[model samples]
Target: MTFKPLLAAALLATTAIAAPAFAGTKMKTEMSATPTSNIVETAVSVDALSTLVAAVQAADLAGALSADGPFTVFAPTNDAFGALPAGTVDTLLKPENKGTLSNILTSHVVAGSYDAASIIALAKANDGKAKLTTLSGAELKAYVKDGKVYVKDENGGKATVATADVQTSNGVVHVVTSVLLPK
Candidate 1:
C-alpha cells in the first residue's frame, strides 16, 4: 500500500480514461478557459496529457500546482514520455526516485503567468531566444524555429509546443512534445 503502487495504478486508470497520447499525433486542446480551468485541470481534461497528470500526482505536486498562483507549465504529452528510452519513465516513477522525479517535473514549470504571445515577444526581444529560470531552479530557453515555439532544457533536451495558449485560471498550459529534464 505504498504511494508508488497507488501512483502507478492511478496513472494506468487515467490512461484508460483518456485517449492514448502518442508522439507525432496532432493533439487538439481547448483554447478557451472557464473560471474553473487551472493548470492541472486543463491538463487532465486533455486526452493527450494523461501521463502528465499522473506524474503530477506521483510527484506529489498536484496540490501545489492546483494552488492559487501564476504558473506557466510546459506540459509534455504522453508521446513525449514514450519517446524516452525504454524504462526511463518507469524508473523515474519509483519511490526511490521521487526527488529526481520532482525535480524533472518542476523543470517544466515557471513561476508567474506567461502566455504564448508574451513568450514569443520575449524571445523576439532576446534576439530569437529567451532563457527562462524554471521552478526547479534550472534554466530552459525558449526559441522559435520553423514558425513553432520550442523550449530547450539545460541537459540539451528540447520540447516543442504541440498546442499553445491553453488558458487557465492559475496560468497557462503549453503542451509540448517532450519532457524537459533537469540539469
Candidate 2:
C-alpha cells in the first residue's frame, strides 16, 4: 500500500470516530444551557415567605408561580399575618380552608406582570385609581399616594406595597404589609 493512501485512510477513520464524540459534547452543552427562568425558579428563596410560602405550596400554586409567565406578586410578609384577627392564619392553614386560602392568595395575583413604574403610570392615568383583575376573579383597586402604591380589595381592605420591584427571571415581587381580604 502507498504511504500516502494509508495516511488518508487513517485520517478518514479518525474523523468518523470523532464525529459521534463531537455530537455528544454538543448535546451536553445544550442541556447545560437552561433558561434563566429555571435558574431563577430554583435560586429564588420563597422560603423566607414562611406562612405565605407554605400557603402557596399548600394551595398547589407553587408550580404556577414558578412557571415561565411573568407575574407580579404582592407578597404579604409574616408580620402581615400577625395583623389579621387572631386564629385567622391558623384557620386558613387547615386543610378544610384550602379553597378559601387559595382564593385569597390568588386574589393577590394579577394575570400579567407589572412593575412599580407601570403601576404608578396606570394609577395616574386613571386619575389616581386603577382596577386590576385578579386570578381569583375579583377586582383589586390600585392607587398611588405620597409616591407609594396601595391596593384595595373588594372588602375595602388596603395594603401598601412596603417594598416594590423585587425582580426575578419569571416575575417581580412587591412586599405588602397587610393581607387584602376580599368581599
Candidate 3:
C-alpha cells in the first residue's frame, strides 16, 4: 500500500464524512436566517417590547397585527410605557378600556410599511413633516429634526426613533422613545 494512495483515500473518506454534516448545518442555518415571525412574534422576542406586547394582547390587536399587514409600527419600549403617568398602562389594559387601548395602539401603526428612509424622504418633501394616517384613521406626523426621526401624535406628543427598520414577516417595527397617543 503506497503512502500517497493511503493519504488520498483518507482525505476522500474525511470529506465524505463531513459533507452530510456540512449540508445539514447549512440547511438549518438557511432556515433560521429567514425571518418567519410576524409582528406579534417579533415583538414577543424583543425584551424591551414586553410591555407593548402585553398591551397588544390585552387590546386583542395581536391577531390583526400578526396578519398580512406590511404595517409600520412605532413600537414603544418598556421604558417608554413606564414613563407614562402612573397607572396609565394598567388602566388601558383593563377590559373596559380595550377600545381606548386599541385606539392608542392603532395610532402608532400606519397601514403600510415605511422604513426610516421613506419616512424621512416623505417628511422632507412635505416641508419637514408628513402625516401618516393610521389604521384607526388618526394621523401621526413624521418629521426629521437634527438628523433624527421623530413621530408626533395629533396631541403633540412626540417620540424619537430609538431603533429603526426591524423587519418581520408581516411588517417592520421602529422602536419609539415614547408611546404615541391618539388625540
Candidate 4:
C-alpha cells in the first residue's frame, strides 16, 4: 500500500484508540500579546506541550523552527502523544528513527503564520475547507464544525484546535487536541 493510505490509517487508528469527544463549542482562540520567544521556546513554555518540544528537539528541528521565517505550528499536547499506541513515542524517539520523527514533527508546521481567523476565513472561502500545506509536504484540511475549528489529516482523522493564535516572535502556535500525521 502507498504511504498516504498508511498515514491515514495510522492517524485514524491512533485517534480512535484514545481521543476524547470534543465538546461542541465555538472556536474562541483569542489573539494574545506577542511572545518574545520563537516557536521552540514558545512550545517549551507550555506545560502541556512538553512532548512536542521533546520531539522537535529529538528531530533536530530546534534551529530551523527558531529561524526568522514565520511558521504556523499545530502543536499536539502531552495527552495527545499519550493517546498513541503504547511504545509509539518511545520508538519514534530512537536515534535511528530521527528521519521518521522529523517528518512527523514537521507535518504539524506550516510555512507561514496562519492565525485562527485566516484559517476560518480561508475555509469559508473555499467551500468550508482550506487545504494547508505543511512543512513536511503534507496537505491538511482546515475547517469549522459545530462552531469549532478542526484540522483533518489526509486520511480523515481530525484534531480540534484547543487553543489558537498564540503569537511567538517568529510565528504562531495553535494547540491541537491530537497529533496530525502526514500522508
Question: Distance (Å) between predicted and true CA of 96, model 3?
Answer: 0.9
Q: How many residue pairs clash in each candidate?
A: 0, 0, 0, 0
The residue-level lDDT of candidate 2 at 10 comes to 22
User: Between prediction 1 and prediction 3, which has the larger TM-score?
Assistant: 1
Per residue, candidate 1 scores C-alpha lDDT tens digits across 1-183 of 112122222222322111122223234553334446667766666667778788888889988888887988899989999999999988888888889999999999999888766787788789888888999999999887765668999988888877766667798777788999886
Q: Residue 59: error of model 2 in Å?
A: 1.2
For the record, the alpha-carbon RMSD of candidate 2 to the native fold, in angstroms, is 18.3
**Candidate 1 similarity to native, TM-score:** 0.82
The alpha-carbon lDDT assigned to residue 95 of candidate 1 equals 83
lDDT of each: 0.75, 0.64, 0.73, 0.75
Error of 3 at 97 (Å): 0.8
All-Cα superposition RMSD per candidate: 7.1, 18.3, 15.6, 11.2
lDDT of 1 at 26: 38
Misplaced by over 4 Å in model 2 are 1-48
**True lDDT of residue 19, candidate 2:** 18
Cα error of candidate 1 at position 30, Å: 5.6
In angstroms, give how far residue 162 of model 1 lies from its true place: 0.8
Tens-place lDDT per residue, model 3, 13-105, is 211111121122111101110256677766665567789989998988888987898999988989999999999999999999999999999
Q: Estimate each model's TM-score.
A: 0.82, 0.74, 0.80, 0.82
lDDT, model 1? 0.75
